[model samples]
Target: SIDRKVGSQLMPDTSPGVSRSSQLDSETHPHVDDTPSSNEHHRPTPLPAQLQGRATNKTFQSMTYVPGLTPKIAGILQSKVPEGTVITSTMSRSPPPPNERSSVVYRLGCKGCEAKYIGATVQKTEKRFSKHRSDVRNGILATALSRHTLSSTGNHEFDFEDFDIIGTEKVRKKLMLLEAALIKQERNRINIQEEFAAIDNCYNNLLLNLNNH
Candidate 1:
């Protein structure tokens, strides 16, 4: 028994056992973790050098369109305005079909003459202007303005700068009343000679009735 004990201490155990050095190595140098660190994930992306000081928040503003100066104006605006500011054009363009939910009252005037035309539209004022132009071009003579343009001016030409939007209203009756009020206020300026009295009388009666109600 004494000899067996001495031999057992001298010979290392080899029955499916790991070496001491390998076990110590595994504890010291563990497998690398493939997951990324939290700091790396939270890092922000860098902006371009030119855009470093510019703001990212946006603001929009309306501007009138000038035929030849619009492009130059836009370029100047882009350079002067902050990086995120947006500019919008207020000039009327071809709008879609009529929408009765919103109504607009507007006026159109001759650039050199005092002749003005008061009008209302259920759709956008742009669409209404397009219709007026179409009627004038076709010689429809449907409105007093069309008649005046055909009789006075040999050609159908008007100044775009003279166009103005008076007001907007959702209610049809209120819109009509507003239109009548504008027409009455600008009565002397309009060019409808024979039809003026009739239109004025009609609007006056409507106003009187509405007031009574």
Candidate 2:
């Protein structure tokens, strides 16, 4: 009887379809992965922490969008605060000065007598008052107030501190009419002859009757 003993199982048999040498080659060197390598150049860098959001300049009208910024690049550039834009903001102007107001009815009081003068001006009140001051001082102008001041008055100045505003009107004739009516309202006044003639004697009689009551 021959004992057919196998010598240490003679290197296990390979599949019928594949050879043993090919299986050994596959186990030693595996398949290559197609993923990127860490050493790969030309890779996109991430944005810096300050510039991470979309607005590097967005949504804010005050900001300017800056591209190509990165933490590493900023550090190399020695970053500092950028200068701000200069805006020429302006405010609306205010109204003219009080004494510079126009279309006004004003009164002037005499320093020596109970004489009052009611007048109106299309120009500024200060301009009219300045002319009146110049008139009494120089005696050049022949305006009604100046005539009275030059001829009848003992005072030098027109008592500008006593200058007062009585009313305001824009229409020329109507403003003069207001001055006329105001002159009538006052008991004592220095007015031009024409203004005095325009008043109704009946109105004076009515005022006299009312005051008597």
Candidate 3:
């Protein structure tokens, strides 16, 4: 009977005892969603398609600072590599102990000759000096000072007492820059033999390349 009555009027039942008032309320004002609308301002904006692809495809690289060669090497890598293909970053050498941190630049004067070798190190001055002496005795031709000592003198032993701390810096870059400056200044004075000129030339080339950058 109720379905027939509502069908005749083509409207929902509003009779007493049939939840009529609630039905009428629902019809007049539909249920409002209690869940809040998403705030566009707080939502994270996605990266652009190109950038997204680049980020996925890009290769990350970490290069250690090589005293004089780092800047030029970094520049070369940036210039030669595709813009989004490779990401290059420079990392400094590992930090030394607190005692060694205060000793940055050092100079080693030859006992026989006036020639001096300027160097920078993050390690303690005494430790570095010991290593240099060891390297010289071991005939390590890789270092200019060691090569000079072996080639220029009859004896391979370096004077441990001849070395002195020239300056100190907290930053390795400042110490390296100071070392480079000192090397440049003392380049002409150092008696690097003709055979060991290549070692010095390679170092000088690095300095030149660094300056060019």
- lDDT by residue (1-213, candidate 1, tens digit) is 999999987785465778866655666877844468789978899999987997766556643332223445476677886454545455387543333223876677865467778777777766667777788889998887777777785543555445666655566666665666556556445635443343456556643443443
lDDT of 3: 0.61
For each candidate in the order shown, give its overall lDDT on alpha carbons.
0.62, 0.63, 0.61
Give TM-scores for every candidate, taking all chains together and pairing residue i with residue i. Answer: 0.42, 0.46, 0.40
Model number with the top TM-score: 2
Which residue segments of model 2 deviate by more than 4 Å?
Answer: 1-98, 196-213
lDDT of 3 by residue, 119-172 (tens): 677877777777877887687876777877878745534566655555555676
- Return the candidate ranking by lDDT, descending: 2, 1, 3
Question: Which candidate tops lDDT?
Answer: 2
By summed lDDT, the worst window of 10 consecutive residues in model 1 runs over 62-71
Weakest ten-residue segment in model 2 by summed lDDT:
62-71
TM-score of 2: 0.46
Clashing pairs in 2: none
Model 2 agreement with the true structure over 23-131: per-residue lDDT tens digits: 6666676674446877687677989876687555523232111111122224443444333233222226773564787887788887777778877789998888888
